[model samples]
Target: MSAVVLSVALSASASADMFKPSKAEQMKLGKQAAAEVRKKEKVLPDSDPRVQLVKRVGRRILSTFSEKEQPWEYSFDVIESKEVNAFALPGGPVFFYTGLLEKFKYEDELAAVMAHEITHVRREHWAYSQRDANKANVLLLGLSLFGGRRDVLSATDLLATFYSLKYSRQHENQADSMGFDMLVAANYNPDGMVLLFETLKQSSKGGKPPEFLSSHPDDGNRIRNAKTKIEKSPKEFPALTKINL
Candidate 1:
């Protein structure tokens, strides 16, 4: 099957993934998962304060994006759960648990979460994961936009289950790096992101770790990476000298 290289707006040196799901397929899986989650999880309404906060922070991160060329549709939802977890469906559905929401003390911290999750969807990480796992139930169904009914259950499980949703370390790094750019582009303090990593590190319980942090063991490395980017302060922002963060 012929496939086009879907280049992501990350570091230019980062190699793009190929032969992944189409935009339509990813959207379909996302819609399917969205329906399933609404039925099974206690998703908060837009009227809820927490949900409102998430949307506000999510918009901040999203506003910095320049990829109107892509067909992905972004949606943010907050679920009433204590688990410190948040994951993104292939198309653009990003869910945040109440636990994660309550943990953030600043808008920047929340923006980091939104930025990271959005990056996963923007970069089509799930489609690449399906390719690695050979899970045709999720991959061949195509990480589409909507209208696909095939493997609906599998796609739903892929979004809700830890095993299916865990991104590889490399993908995690890319999301962090690219997400940093998004946060900075929005003119928010990038240090909040590093603070989030520290929050995760300090909050991990029982050595088991939350599903979100369990997949990647290198939290320290990610923190270091964020600091490095801030220190380097590329030409994108020349006022770096005045910004304390």
Candidate 2:
């Protein structure tokens, strides 16, 4: 029985290896999907002063953290919505909601949030996730073709869903860490990261939590992590010098 189990495990591992997609293929597919999503999404104008400010700050922070010699163009825009959310897609597409900007008490806090989202792109976290999803689908297809088992295909689909969700959470944590480092390197106040989380926690108290809050992990956990990092390496806050707002 032990030998049989070992043989089954080896087979599964080999199948998994065969399913993995190349990074180039994943990038092509991800860019195509992103283009479709962008068409449906409304992006704020670059001419807007607030939008420009975000870009300026984002560039500064990103320049410090990103070592990749490639030309990474960063675009920051304020979506015309009240949702307290910000997201960065693969290839440096970033959107920040007006509500999130209103919640920031300090510029550093805003920068911290921007840095966190930007890290998602810089680290290619989304690309990796997309690659993994494609790989899973490939594996499912192979199983259906070779094993001729409908059950295997169903199981693979379910596993892919779970894996996607799990990968999202992992990506969030990684961005958080990268953001912390980026903010510190740029000489921005790291406490701003904690403050942003505190704002989110407070916002969730009375009314229904926003979609962003629901999608992200607990604000308390994020705040705690930010605070711990801040205490270790505190940086002076920059003066409010002609903010675009």
lDDT of 1: 0.72
Worst 10 residues of 1 by lDDT: 4-13
Residue 151 displacement (Å), model 2 = 25
Model 1, position 132, has a per-residue lDDT of 56
- For all candidates, the clash counts are 12, 0
Q: For this target, which candidate reaches the highest lDDT against the unseen true structure?
A: 1
Per-residue CA lDDT of model 2 for 190-216, tens digit only, reads: 777777777877887776554335557
Highest TM-score model number: 1
Residue 223 in candidate 1, Cα distance off native in Å: 0.9
Q: lDDT scores for all predictions? A: 0.72, 0.63
lDDT of 2 at 172: 78
